[model samples]
Target: MIYGVVNLRREATLPLVVGNMNKQQQVIDTVIDTGFSGFLSLPSSIISALDLPWSASDIVTLGDGSETLFDLYAANVIWDGQYREIYIAESETEPLLGMALLYGHRLQIDAIEGGSVKIEAL
Candidate 1:
């Protein structure tokens, strides 16, 4: 299996466009939530600011309880390093990198020798 990991810093939240029905949603910070099972977690304020359109979806897990926040969409793909669209999502979760992303691209993670996280693409 091709596996890799990257050193994603909180300060490096990617800025991309998101929405449904071809509408561009708000630009929010998307943290690399490898711990959780969601693709992206849009804060209540961000959801309100973007005026996102959503319906009742399956609740996603945060830890002990479910997340009661913005709606989730089918973001099966995202902007690549060069800003190219790529399919990634396979699992449905709130603001997280589900198995789909980790296994879809066959990526692996490891500790960097110099106090950094390394992501290797297979």
Candidate 2:
């Protein structure tokens, strides 16, 4: 099981440990975005700091129906106590944990400030 907490903004925020094969790692707070179909989204600064490798670019439609290109980067994350490889989309917004990463897992959120957030493997 994975544990997290709801922030003051009522976002189901969780900590994600991103790392590379060289052992460089950083724990980032990410908001769970159910509307996002991708795996993860990270700020450019974090990607630069982590030295993550460039993967590719893809067109993504925004909430406003506008389409934009996003740079994809190769990354590894510690999920449910195991290391899993995932792609990170470069975005200027706050880090987002999307549905692709939550696939096959159960998510429970209290939906209040300082409330509990839990993710369990099926």
Candidate 3:
């Protein structure tokens, strides 16, 4: 099981450890974005700091229905006590943890500031 917390903004968030091929890693606070169907999104600064390798670029639709191209990078992430390789999209917004990363897991959120957030494997 993975444990997290709801922030003051009421967003369900999880702290994730993201790494590069060289083993450089950083702890990132990621907001849980159910509307996102991909794996993960991180800011350019973090990506640069980690020196994540570029994979490809793809156009993605935003929440406001606008389309924009995003640069994708290969990253290693520690999720639920396991090391997993996943794609990370470059975004200017706060890091986002999407449904792709949450698939096969049960998510429970209390929906309030300082509330508990939990993810249990199926």
Candidate 4:
């Protein structure tokens, strides 16, 4: 298991937007999941703010034995002292960062354990 001190941010919800594509702006919230697998989620309030080109085409399985459709988009994220461009799936509402990105990042929950996890960029 990997362990490290991570920087977390509570992003503000903004409309989905692709400022570089020269397409219509998509307003979306800024709440990015540190461990999220590329997806954009928002409340109705947030979606209403955007100029959606079309509905999302992907379907995601939920934890409650159900499935829901999520929106997907290309987003630019600045984190861990670096900037990255990733595709984010859209949802109505969800928590920040899931385990997928966490595992990919090799992040470990560091408490006071003697064999705590620490991560450092090379």
TM-score leader:
2
The residue-by-residue lDDT of candidate 1 on 35-54, one tens digit each, is 65544555455454544455
- lDDT score for residue 80 of model 1: 40
- List candidate 1 stretches off by more than 4 Å: 1-12, 64-77, 81-103, 106-122
Clashing pairs in 2: none
Candidate 4 structure quality by residue, lDDT tens digits, 50-117: 43334346777766667777765554443344444444455656423443333445444333323334
lDDT of 3 by residue, 14-120 (tens): 99999999999999999999999889999999999999999999999989999999999999999889999999999999999999999999999999899999999
**Among all candidates shown, the one with the greatest lDDT:** 3
Position 52, candidate 2: lDDT: 96
Candidate 2 — what's its lDDT?
0.95
For TM-score, candidate 1 versus 4, the one ahead is: 1
Ranking by TM-score: 2, 3, 1, 4
- 1 against 3, candidate with superior lDDT: 3
Superposed Cα RMSD, model 1: 6.7
Runs in model 2 with CA error above 4 Å? none
Could you tell me how far off, in angstroms, the CA of residue 21 lies in candidate 2 after the best superposition? 2.4
